[model samples]
Target: MPTEVLHRLSTLSLTSVKQLGRLPRLSSSLPALPAPRPTLAASEVPTLFREPHILSGYRPAGQPWSSYLLSTFQWHNESMNVWTHLLAAPLLLLRCWSLLEGAGGPWRLLGDVAALPLVLYVVSALTYLACSVAAHLLQSRSELTHYSVFFLDYVGVAVYQYGCALGHYFYGSEPRWRDDILGGLMGAVYLPSAALLAWMSCACCCFAKAHYRRPYPPRRKVVQLIPTGLAYVLDISPVAHRLLVAGDWQRDDDGALGFHAAQVVFFMMAAMFFSYPFPECCLPGHCDIIGHAHQLFHFFLALCTVCQLEALFRDFLARRAAILDVHGGELVVGAGVSFFVLVLCCLATAVWMRRTVQKRLKDQQA
Candidate 1:
């Protein structure tokens, strides 16, 4: 009787374990996602959804949000635009995950305050990539959604430009250049004005987008790119100075120079396509579904960002000892303060821009 009783209890224990294992499977069997929506031509969607020379393969506006999410897997005018940054976001995260947990291991990172800027840079890069992904994916839902998401996208760009300024200024810069004048933005407060430029550029872009019609004219293009270009020039100052004026290119001790040069080249190439539409402008509807300039633009921009991160990471490591000596514990305070200020400013700017977008959208509807 004792043996039988023990045997029954053992069987019940085994059964309970098996049931617990099965529970996970049951829990994981979630409802299936929506299937991809049927795509439309440029003519099918309203003019607001259309892009010049992109004659086909637009997702119909007002799809359930799920359909837009599912469209990530399907082909459309925005597929590469969605994927280039979507895939890159995870890749960037994967590359930076170890660093976030502490670059010199968790313990060493506690003392290495200089790693702060790199951490901020990583977070900013991820923010921009995620925003770009959201913008490309959901921008087709409605006029309001289109404006709203893209406004957020511009905010992301502003954040990222400030981040790039941080990484380049601290890690990649020549110290002599750091002392130069720009509204006494010396030390960690470097480029506060540049941040304003970026913020104002977002406002400029929003205004252009609101007022301009599809197939934006040269005037609209100028309004969009002029301030943005100026911001780019200022934000890129450190790297540009290092590569051009400081002659950092002549030194190849860490392979950072190569990566830096590659980033510049890739970014300029991508920016050209972003501005002009290039061969797509020449080919038009023939290139709509498969090979479009915007698609190539997305690809090259991803590559540029990857190269930028690579170079900046290399520089951070190579200059760590010097950074620690020159900056001391100020590394934590300086980087933290600057990033905090930038976030506050960006959030404020985005909120103001959102209100403007809402007003414009309401006016359009009315």
Candidate 2:
């Protein structure tokens, strides 16, 4: 194969950091400098800092952290990506707070362990958005920061998936589905498997990030996407089962079923954007600063979250009694502990991968 073709093919995937065949020899002495201008065209920035089909508005790598944060005020490629979640983060927080206040203020949540799932959902939502903001906003500071920031972002994604599963299992599931589906595997495998899948998703995504270099190959998407898709399927299975089973799909106490139904639709729509570089790939530079597919992904995802929060809150109000009556101890403590365990495991994995990234950087310097 030609050298360029061989290098491109090598980037399809890698088994480990050491397998980064002919690693891209990134600059090792980029100063912590300020932005030279508002933004650079794609040709000016490092390939690693550029986006697919995005031919302009690239932030220069190695700028001080504040430049990136301040860039939120400037129109750049990532401006919408940052604000989409940054703006939605506050709205989601207020909505959850309002629900808690109406229920008798924040202390009310503390009074009942049964509220842990809801609490987890809120935390997971906010955490993921915050992680995304940090990643997109500051990732340009350096290649190492890029990997580290996105490793954290990947953790947030997995954490959110697990939170969604907890909410679905606790609030959205029908009793019959719980007892009947897969011979009640949810009773035994749901939480543990969700946790495991969450960890796996995080690890696999980090691997893909490390395995592939920019400009990333087409197959790189599939490598990272498979694990994420698996995690989402597992995370949403409880609700999927409930929605599929006719016996309980008709039951609409508190009208949560409608909200749950809407969430499913929105999520599926969002998946399209998540999996493809659409609209943007079709018209590259035109969508650089706005109307980007990733921005669309965030928008649709936020819609999904809106529907999910409403449905889960409604269930908490109307279905909590029945759910509690059946499963007296929801293992609220164990569930909380499980989430933290996932957090620790993901952090450890991120840290380990980061060490590998640090080594790669050193090798490039060599």
Candidate 3:
């Protein structure tokens, strides 16, 4: 057979070794391989790895007091909310310092004359700090926590208002407790009245929590106290009016508060302004926006600060004009503390109002 024909026949027959087979040339082609991966050892793994399910990690409820306090700085809704008021405590301390330094020489002699007002200020600051932190942290924890913290917040407010009244009483000549006939009787009514309101609010909150097995609403008590506190604040206007009758100046056993009815009246009005829980009056969602009841309360509180300052200035001037000699430093300190507190309360009110409004609006849209 011809060579080509033989080659074809051999290739086709699968017997090409003799007729058509030839050695093959090899190329660089090879099988693919995977890249090497790094391995992790049990010891090399982080402690967090042992608990794989704890991606977020469950934090126990009974966190330490210091931990809870430090937690305010972390990523929580109340982080900013909590610190805002906590900052006020230090600011008040600073005010106390400034007040001491600014007070004239004659004022320093009275030992702890400011004890009541100062104590009130401290309690108010502490109560607010606790309320702010507790409300911020616990309100979201559980239903019980929510109600407890909320009641505490109201109690803080009541204490703050009562402190304002107490501060004013310090400037007056009458002892908070005088058993001298009309003086004693007045003290009996006024002092106990304020105390009773505070106690009732606290009691109601406690009773509601314990007996009702629910969050007690302090709204009714607040409603009752609003008018009563306002009346008490207004009733003191007679004193202010009496001061006015004595001309633009009058002297008390201690010093002189400005006798101008305008100034005194302004101060009295501020107290009345703070007496009401304006936060409750807001039409649910509306005030939650830019002008909530809390904000209004803050504004009134701020106004009280300004008014008190004005009253203080008037008092100082009157004292200067009268050439009277008495230490009024405590009163000044009390006022300064109140002013700082007023600013803090105002800021809190603003923030809360913003949150409330945002929440309401989102709810509506949803």
Candidate 4:
């Protein structure tokens, strides 16, 4: 009887050990607890949502980086803003690659004096759009992140403008000025303009309280328009000179002038939407999800960019022989050096702005 009891006890102990082993496996197979969503403050989101009827899907500040990134898959106010440019960046890059690889009129002319600057312009556009994507995506993470991302976005715009000016200097017209003079003039005009835009963007992000209070305050609109106006002036001056002074309008392709006109129109529309915040201002909450002015602004800006590229390509095709024959190696080198220097300055400014934001945050916390 005692032996039988001991044997039974041993069997029971063995079964208990097996059950314990199975318990861990069961636990391992169980789903993990979902991470908590960040709690957002009212001010963290766009001011338009301040109206009770408008639902602002505001993500909380101080979210984990992984959480913010994962938020891309979720629906929010910024979802369209983030995805529009994010998806467009790759498409634009593919288009650029196709243009570079295809053998044809403008593609063949790519080896000419304007090739490098044109390439730079394409790269700058990609960079600007990519930065916009990043800024919109991660701006919700924290105030520091918001300020830093905005500064970077501004820098991206400045870089693209610099490239635009470089391309215009190199290829927009027949080389009337000496290569050195052209290079010097471009650097003088665009470098200061770029610097000013960057500074203004940083100031807008850092010190412009009106931006947070409303979408389109007159003061804020003026501040924003200043950069866009400066960019237009810089970009269009060469086109005007080509048409008016160089008499290149006669050689333009059938649709080139129309495309240029469309480009200007689109840019103006973007500015108007950006500055006025129309339709949404009128309808308020009704258009919150689908049809906001800022979204329209983005779409128009993209169209403007496409038109600009088309115009540039048309000009390139028309002036291929002259561009190839021109000996402007020194001008090309100067533009390249200036581009690098501008990029470095932008980086330094971004870092400085980031530090300033961080320090301010720390002070507030203290």
Q: In lDDT terms, how accurate is model 2?
A: 0.78
Give the range where candidate 2 is weakest over 10 consecutive residues by summed lDDT.
19-28
Candidate 4, run of 10 with poorest lDDT: 31-40
Per-residue CA lDDT of candidate 1, range 227-298, in tens? Answer: 888887777777887777887655757777777777788889988987887677889888776578887787
Clashing pairs in model 3?
258-315
Ranking by TM-score: 2, 1, 4, 3
Per-model lDDT? 0.74, 0.78, 0.41, 0.62
lDDT of 4 at 339: 80
Top-TM-score candidate index: 2
**Clashing pairs in model 4?**
none
- The total number of steric clashes, by the backbone 3 Å criterion, in model 2 comes to 0
Error of 1 at 239 (Å): 1.8
Model 4 TM-score relative to the real fold: 0.75
Name the better of 2 and 4 by lDDT.
Answer: 2
List the RMSD of every prediction in angstroms: 12.8, 12.1, 29.8, 18.1
Question: How many pairs in model 3 have backbone atoms within 3 A of each other, for residues 3 or more apart or on separate chains, i.e. clashes?
Answer: 1
lDDT of 2 by residue, 134-223 (tens): 998998878899899999999999899999988987877666767777787666688888899889899989999988988788788887
Query: Clashing residue pairs in candidate 2, if any?
Result: none
Best by the lDDT measure: 2
Better of 3 and 4 by lDDT: 4
TM-score of 1: 0.83
